[model samples]
Target: MAAQASGDLSLVGISKEFETFTAVHPLDLEVPAGSFFALLGPSGCGKTTTLRMVAGLEEPTTGKILIGDQDITDTKAFRRNVNTVFQSYALFPHMTVLENVAFGLKRRGDKDAVAKAKESLELVQLGAVAKKKPAQLSGGMQQRVALARAIVNRPDVLLLDEPLGALDLKLRRQMQIELKRIQSEVGLTFIHVTHDQEEAMTMADSIAVMNAGRIEQQGDPASLYEHPKSVFVANFLGQSNLLRASIEGPGAEGTVMVSSHGQRLEADASHIPEGAREIWLGVRPEKLRLGEGGGPNRLHGVVADASFTGVATQYLVRLPWDQEITVVQQNDGSARALEGENVTVSWASHHGFVLDAAEPADAGLGHEDG
Candidate 1:
């Protein structure tokens, strides 16, 4: 079977409301053709609602959804050139894997359904198990079957709503790689909705972090991780040590001075958010290095706790201001800190990220006034 021509997806001022409750605020978003896009957020943050709107399963309260040049907001679910894979595999219990994969094509009156299904099964590495029933397959195999069933139809866009949620941790990780590989080989536009940060980061070409019916940040995973604009994004996407500090204006050689608890630190001014005064200086735990001296961006603290993980050592340091900061260093077999010893934490100026101190107006502020 020929592959479906991929199309870019567009949501223009889309919003959803349930009587007095608003699930999604007015939003505009775009997914490029043949790109792996992820809508990442916690539960009730409207990621699923937005996906359902794209799938035509939930009607948008306002605005239009488009696929390339065609308006699909009001189109019926089955009439649109799109397919959805839910968390549940939803395979037919009694039907063989091949039959289940070919069912959609058969219903559409395609004469070569079985042959196409076999090809899809091979794409997902389940061609040998085509004769097995859903009950006979493992959770991972059943998921591959489900994916085969969806991709067999060769839809213009594929919507995945936490399809790997049912798999175990190891299986989930494996499927994440599998799914990305399949998507790349097929060149399909895949819009994935997931609450798992790791899953989104691992699979998506680009990600939009949603919270309280709004997008807190959107970019490639590295960009978002290295420079988060808001506190919600800094804390949500990964573990960040956010220190309350006031910008003491510009420093020498393109650096900005930040004062926290009488200690002055310098950060790359280019990375600081525009118009931010009192800011939260963010540094990933893994970016911090432990030593015993004052430096450009340094903090002196006492080692409160330390844990030895296989890949690295995790340290909890108590600062003079009665606050704790976490640090992670690679297990390079160097001098380690004792629990009661005082230590200095240091990082390069370029590694620091500055975020606005004030929370977003709608962040945990509830729904907008009607």
Candidate 2:
């Protein structure tokens, strides 16, 4: 798989509407040349719709799209230099893998279409199965054929809409790495759409988190995970215990004193408004230390439940206000606490993130509008 020269992609105030329902809100995004970017959200978050508009498959109700400085908003799907690997793989069952891969090149009337198709099949490591129909291949192999078909034309951008959605868990994990490798080899700007947070975190250089047709946050995975901007982002990105807190007074480093479950805790809040009295504090389960801890934020709780995973143990601790906080502990030689045991949970002050208390717009699940 020879890498294609990189190209830039831009979406400016793009929006899509079907009758009275707005499937995608006006949004702007810029994907740098050769970057592996992901649009991540639960189903119905408009990630797919946004991807469709960028691929020229769906006309935006407003705004413009650009590929390598070329205005492509009004361009037809076939005219644009972009290819999409749909969720369904969409391979022609009757056509052999070789012919299916060669289909796009045949339409372009390329003289070396058949040879190029063979080369692409080899790139995807599917040349050995070239003579077999899609029905004869495994789901992963079929997906590879679909990928070969799309890349055989060597488009400027490759849009992957849940390309690994059909595979089983183990296969999906394997395909994530494969997809990343292929994207790197192709050097095409890969814009992937997926609802799986772990998938997005593993493969993307940057992620755009969408909610209810609007982008909630966009950043590198580390930044998004460490400093989520809203409650929705904090909860959606991974498991986190959200605790209701009331700001009390000024504290160290421009932080404010907050009270939660009758315990006073200090946290940095230079970014938060001074007079704002109430906020939701987000603490990752892994950040919480169990038993008598020596951290900045400490609290007493009773173990409500415990579950043992292969590598770690999960404990649900009940607080004074009936709030449940989850804690994850590595499975080491240390004795694991049983359910109904009294325990103290603690974490560093820096580990907590304060989010505004508000219900985000409902983002539905999976290709509803499309």
Candidate 3:
């Protein structure tokens, strides 16, 4: 299969409502042509519903769907240039891999269906299994067949709705890389909807974090992880430690000063959200260094727990206010903190972001990583 280009995808004011509840609210989004975009959120956050609306599988309550300059809102699911791959591969169990991949082309009476299917299988690196039935393949190979089938159709947009959900941990991680590689090689517009934070981060050029039928934030992986805009995004996208604080005023060199339990601290002004009646200092576990008096922003705490996970050591540090904060340190021969040891946690002010204290502190806890 030669590399093919796709039109940019657009969703304008799209919403889906049932009798009692709205699965998705009015939403406006644009995906650049051939970009790997992810709709990421926990269950019931509307990511899947929004993907379904685009696939024309579910009628939208309002708004239009477009590709480039063309409107496709009312087009039939089969008529529109879109293909979907679900968690279930749904490959014909009794048919050969090539036959299954060529099913759609053959149904449409395309003369070169068999030839095209061969190329598609090769693109997914499964040409050798073209003659084998799906039952004769492993789970990962079965998944590649599903991908080859979808790519053979050459749709303007490919919608993946938790397609890797059934794979085990190691396989899922490996497939994440393969999926990204395939998308890049084909240069097709790929819209992936998944609940796994790491999967989205690993494969997507951009990600929209959804919460309660609304897009909380959308940006590149690093921006979302380093500078989340809300409590939900900060908590949901990854683990974070939020400290109760009050804005004291400005600090030296364009920094925002805050007071936590009468202790002064500094953070980059951009990290602090505006009009914050109440405040919480946001920091990532990896950004914190276990030590005393090392950074412009420092806190005194006692080591509550330490866990070594090969690559790094994670610690639970308890502050004087009785709040426990998480810290992660690279296991690079640095002194490790032991349990019940008094210590200070430090980080550069620029590494921290602030969020309004009004939102639920534990907003995104207990989400399934599938």
Candidate 3 wrong stretches, greater than 4 Å: none
**All candidates' TM-scores?**
0.95, 0.92, 0.98
Give lDDT tens digits, candidate 2, residues 256-359: 78988688987777545335577777788998999657467888889999999989999999987788889999998789988988888988778888776554
TM-score of 1: 0.95
Q: Please give me the total number of clashing residue pairs in predicted model 1.
A: 0
> What residue pairs are clashing in model 2?
43-364, 43-365, 43-366, 44-364
Provide the lDDT at 330 for model 3: 92
- Per-residue CA lDDT of model 3 for 1-370, tens digit only, reads 4455557899999999989999999999999988899999999999999999899999999999999989999999989999999989999988999999999999999999999999999999999989999999989999989999999998889999999999999999999999999999888889999999999999999999998899999999999999888888998888999988899888988797899898899978876676884788889999998875457888898999999999999999999999999998999997888999999899999889889989878878867752
- Report the number of the highest-lDDT candidate: 3
The per-model lDDT (C-alpha) reads 0.88, 0.85, 0.91
Error of 2 at 248 (Å): 2.6
Please estimate how well model 3 matches the true structure, expressed as its whole-model Cα lDDT: 0.91
Give me the candidate number with maximum TM-score: 3
